[model samples]
Target: MPQLDISPWPMVILSMIAALFYFIQLKLLNFTFYNTPLSKPMKTQKHKTTWELKWTKIYLPLSMSQ
Candidate 1:
């Protein structure tokens, strides 16, 4: 076999590191969001992820402040 090509190893390592960081960030966000004292917990995961909610949160503040 030809000498193992080491060129791709860096990318593989970087991808693994990126995945690790993403999961870490997700876990932190989940704990912070879900444990909040809301009267009614979110009915669905999409309730927060939907673009409309995110847009409204971002838009309302700017409109009100202006």
Candidate 2:
């Protein structure tokens, strides 16, 4: 095999560092960008009546239940 003029160790180390950096960047980007926000969509009704019914049932007074 023909001899290389420069040692390949520095290139190898640089490539490894670059790869690690890219992986971390992609991980951070996906975490921030891919997750949907918890806000209700515009088309869906807020359903305030349903929420009130559920909560009222969940916290009904003992006297009321008797």
Each model's lDDT: 0.78, 0.80
Worst 10 residues of 2 by lDDT: 51-60
At residue 20, candidate 2 shows an lDDT of 100
- Tell me the lDDT of model 2 at 53: 68
Best by TM-score: 1
lDDT by residue (1-66, candidate 1, tens digit) is 779889999999999999999999989987845566668765765445576555453356654756
Candidate 2 backbone collisions, by pair: none
Worst 10 residues of 1 by lDDT: 54-63
Off by over 4 Å in 1: 33-66
TM-score for each model: 0.45, 0.39
What is candidate 2's lDDT per residue for 1-66, written digit by digit as tens? Answer: 998767888999999999999999989987854677698767966766766666444566777854
- State residue 57's C-alpha deviation in candidate 1, in Å: 75
